[model samples]
Target: MLVFSDLEDQSGIWEETKDLFASDFLYHHKLTEYNDEIYLDALDDIQEHVWNCGGGKITQYGLPPSRDGEKTSNVIRREKSYNKESLQKNVNEKMSLLNDKQRHCYDVVMSRIKNGCIFNSNGIFLNAPGGTGKSFVLNMLLDSVRSQGKIALAVASSGIAATALHGGRTAHNMFKIPLMEYNEIRTCGIKKNSELARLLQMTSLIVWDEVVMANKNTLTALDITLRDILGNNKFMGGIVFVCAGDF
Candidate 1:
């Protein structure tokens, strides 16, 4: 004979009581108890008064609203707010600065994007010594994708490197990959219904700068999480993935 003023307040026990029987009860009576026997007895009457408002709103436990406790909507908005015209202008200016070898790398990556690299194995690794403009080429690739009204994720293994790219974020922060040692089956901490998940689904390209510094397990965790969120078993959920570093 549990009593409550509002069902919403008892959301914690909602699922536990879903199967409870009222012993003998039916609607609009100020108190309705549900039991298999009573429910069957008053089936027709109960059907008349029953209407589905919708599923109860429950936030997933251990899930934060967004990365670093930021608002979910703010994260989503920031990802999509880049000006296509401005990005295109910046890309055009930067194009002329690329060396011949760098320009060739840029063309190869852009071709992958135009041809829908998601359906195929489109992964690139730029291995060169320092002072070779790896960051310059990575930035060019990011701008090209974003200028076309598509999402391009730019992340780096370290904070200093991440700050150099447009809209860049630390790889661990962006994907919620754990820092400590983890099992092979472990995935990132991203929830499927989270705002970060939505952004990942919409992304066309992912440029990881200084990727050589990241742990192998961190990369594997990202792979597992992306596949789960995007519902695609393909590598990195079919996003064009680029890894650039001196290693």
Candidate 2:
């Protein structure tokens, strides 16, 4: 049996060889043991085979043992075959279309998705001067997310603006925002409406446009309602909130 005077000295080689075996020939045989001498002897055998065949020097590392008890020569063939197939598969699925900026945004969004969208900030404020393409950017992002099979909802202070963004009425109409009755204070219970409740629960992205025009009291009320329904599970609503407005 091949042995090593100090196993730790060759630990790196052993790990690399193990990964090679798993990726290249895992189904062929089970690796019962690992020894430095055995690995080195396998390499020498490969070199000898190449020499006998009158080929150039065949330098390689981490050869897998054969399932049929053949020499290490078979291991190299298996690795070549496996690697070629995996490479082709990867190339075939590569992305076809995405501008640089869009790709960057997509990567950021994907990272957030992997981490589960419970962003630290209570909200994200995207600000720009009027007609600075803020709305254009928002619409592009919305389209990208939707293309990925996500649902995005757009709401604005004005019905016309909201309709322009989402192809429908304002968030008030979509979310059923009622006119708050003065003095009653509690009479305007927009949060209690089942429709708004469902939207809040299921929306993956909430784009509140023209936030500057939103009344202070109504904004406060909306925040309170969100806190009550969403609780402390910041991302529980299935949507990340993004507010865009001009100062």
Candidate 3:
């Protein structure tokens, strides 16, 4: 049985358990012994509960997957507090650490993100060579937007570039951009109804670093997938896809 007292702990498992069984005390009582029929019954109940919570007929996966053969790792993470006041204060303090140029860039990005500039279907490319505090500004942008109940997808063209920011991953890894050399592989590895599609749809901003080095093929692949899922052919389907690089 999952630990009831630790439901609020940030781990994915306990959070999912807590979400599935709102009454921690009840689940605690239900788990008297391991492999007991009662325990199994409780498991079944929680599975059904999760399924029901997800709109009952596989709108998404918290329970059984919609595709039988599809494999997934449904990691349930407890989200950081989205208290705007608290986050704004923290962001302000972080801004103080930024140099003038960095602060200016951060402010512009923040304004655009908050005021729906991304809806214009034109992506922005910020160019600043190494040591211009590009990473600092990116971090600030991610934190500020994520704090205000928005999703910021951070990725970099290469593995090394990916490590510079929080929650960063390689563009290929995060967007499922395959390394195929031919244009025949048009769409990305994301399915319209899958969780990856859901994530892309939920994302309001995408920050890509080291764009100078990323293959054009890779970007094209991502562009195609975004268009398919977003139901439009415009840039990232009206989502902000900011590419940053410097000579």
lDDT of each: 0.70, 0.50, 0.65
Clashing pairs in 2: 204-239
Q: Tens digits of per-residue lDDT for model 1 on 76-162?
A: 555565667877888888788998999989988888888864446778898889888998899788878877988888999999999
Which stretches of model 2 miss by more than 4 angstroms?
1-114, 181-195, 233-238
Question: What lDDT score goes with residue 183 in model 1?
Answer: 57
Residue 170 of model 2, lDDT score: 65
For residues 91-158, could you state the per-residue lDDT of candidate 3 as single tens digits?
A: 87877798777777776776667776544645788898788777878878877887777788889988
**How well is each residue in 8-98 modelled by candidate 2, as lDDT tens digits?**
4333564466445343123221234544433544544444454456543432222333233333343223222222343334323443344
Clashes of 3: 0
> What are the RMSDs of all candidates, in order?
17.0, 23.3, 10.7
Residue 58, model 2: lDDT of 35
- Which residue pairs come into collision in candidate 1? 21-34, 21-35, 22-33, 22-34, 22-35
Stretch of 10 with least lDDT, candidate 1: 55-64
